[model samples]
Target: MAAGAPRIFVSHLSGIAVFDPAGDQVGRVRDLVVMLRVGQRPPRLLGLVVELATRRRIFLPMTRVTAIQSGQVITTGVLNVRRFEQRPTERLVFGELLDRRVTLTETGEEVSVLDLSVHQLPARREWEIDRVFVRKGRKGSAFRRAKGEALTVEWTAVTGFSLEEQGQGAESLLATFEQLRPADLANVLHHLSPKRRAEVAAALDDDRLADVLEELPEDDQIEILGKLKEERAADVLEAMDPDDAADLLGELPTDDQERLLRLMQPGDAADMRRLMSYEDRTAGGLMTTEPIVLRPDATVADALARVRNADLSPALAAQVYVCRPPDETPTGKYLGTVHFQRLLREPPPSLVSSILDRDLQPLDPEAELPAIAGFFATYDMVAAPVVDEAGSLLGAVTVDDVLDHMLPEDWRETEFHLDEEVATDGS
Candidate 1:
């Protein structure tokens, strides 16, 4: 909780009233609006948008916030309280200037504001805004004319408000990950700043963190890990699939990688290190150590019980591997896999072998990328088991790792991508 950061009780928000410095009751707070500022020590609070009488709304500068009490917001100055000038074109609070025309200093060309992003100065309380978007207007315009010139103001150009002037005590109404689906969380993460993202990640428990991390791209995983403390990072990594942990650790510098590994429990670190020893593109590199394995002679009821009781990873495939007795060498004898969906559709007393798919195609530890890809392409496999030459089940790889190799870089630009556009509106 750095100084000047809004102290609104985000979790306990409800029935919180907002008042101006003049002590006039404006309205109850509907939500606390926030803007993400990357690389900033403490992310900036752009302003607070309050819901007022008759569905009216007003944007109050963060500067006017005075105090954030349990049930009310206190402002340092009186707000106009009149209905805000409607700007439906600027529906999004972020990059509000997008689509508006502005003049570029060097090129002297009129460009449509496509996006606005925030960049924070490390170790400082300040933020710089960046704008990005496609250019509009004639090619040779000496002086570019700004569309809606009044709204093209840069972030720095506005300086009338003070830290305490923004209406204080309004709470954030955004849903937590537990409250949102994974796809929804993905969408929200795209909109948040790095610092804000860390806050959101910190809120998740190890289980949820594991689920979310698997869904994020490798680059995003690295970015998020870079922002977290070593302890928190270790917690997240340890909870993830072993192969994912190895991949993420491999992305960091030598010192950072070692430091994080040291922070992990010995068992967890050893497993990750073993996985890291394999080439990243190989089957050995992508396999997870925690595959669901059971004895080949086990009854379907027994196997089903284990599946129900086991704390399976979120990335678990629909099938459970069955091996012969002496579980350690089950992959050697190669019993087969029981498709969970199929088992549920059959009688409970059926033998495991009756439901097993014996024609499974296994991957050798030393298999090359092209061979691995072709195996998946030929069989339409969702996951494949990796085995040693002796047929010992070493681990298993899912389709996700292979897909990562095929995707292009920069497929999804982060919310921070628009930082330049927002910065252009400097004081």
Candidate 2:
């Protein structure tokens, strides 16, 4: 084997063949076993399964294996036919060792792992297996128990072979946010190093980034934002709702906040500025620029087509508003709102006015937070349209925006916990 090449392990005595000095097949590889010490008992090589050309499986001693290579195994000597007749135990030790999860100690916490490490002792010319490293679970807590608390095992503590399954059909060493639930992603973020966090943020698409950001704590959001370049920070902010953008920007240094705002699109920047202009705890401050508006004369087909053309967020309101003109009043004078599902099910050629629900509930742009929350709760609304005093439609507020205000501190902490959990689980 070449020095420093990736190492591989095969089942000992797994019907491998070896060549002698004359370049002839000698015998099948029998056993490559290691001894474990559980408080000073004499170590044993442990029996291994070996097979011969006669189609017989046998128990082979550990000393038989001479060399191991990428594609084949070599044995020390040719075996007698009768020696291969003995049957070995059907169960393999390695499989049993890996079947259970391990917990390693780290910074006074236990970390769960799917595998352990194996090492060779040159001085004693023996192999040693000790210390298990965890790859999943809470950011700082492990699934397994140790002496008092899980002990942090050093990298050097791992000596030889890794117990993790190799080759195909193994769990991936690297985990992506897609593989994790939003809650899990939040937990993992807390444990990630600054650079790793940046890498993960950079890897997430705009929509996913927005979702993950909404779940993160304010302090974490500010920390992550500080680490990102202006353009990337702007991209993440652009993906966030106006209220979220305002809150995160409020947490950042004034200069950084201004620089990021400058990098955002003019319209997005304007909306964020307007939202921030209001007191942080008001309805206008939390509304989104995602109201569904349709011209009164527009047919159900036209409205559906417009919906198709627009890049609407998933959290958008189900109700589509009907307006006489873009700048006209949105009160009783105009055709009201219709559920999107109703529009889709109705005949395409039907006029929006024929199905518009006139029993519309509108929100004042300057309404207080509690009143808006009550409106959302009472009506069971995902979004409520906001209008000026003259009833000119301003924008809309979604449930998530309201949630930010209702439980600001708890929400931030939950997000922080989630980020930490994901990092530990990912490792």
lDDT of 1 at 200: 65
Best by lDDT: 1
| Segments of candidate 1 deviating more than 4 angstroms | 1-178, 183-187, 217-220, 306-315, 325-333, 412-427
Model 2: which ten-residue window has the lowest total lDDT?
416-425
Provide the TM-score for each candidate, comma-separated.
0.56, 0.55
Q: Rate the local accuracy (lDDT) of all candidates.
A: 0.60, 0.58
Tens digit of per-residue lDDT, candidate 1, span 31-72: 434543323222344445677666777665444556666577
lDDT of 1: 0.60
- Over 33-104, each residue of candidate 2 has an lDDT whose tens digit, in order, gives 443332222122333455545655444433344445644655444333344322121224344443244333
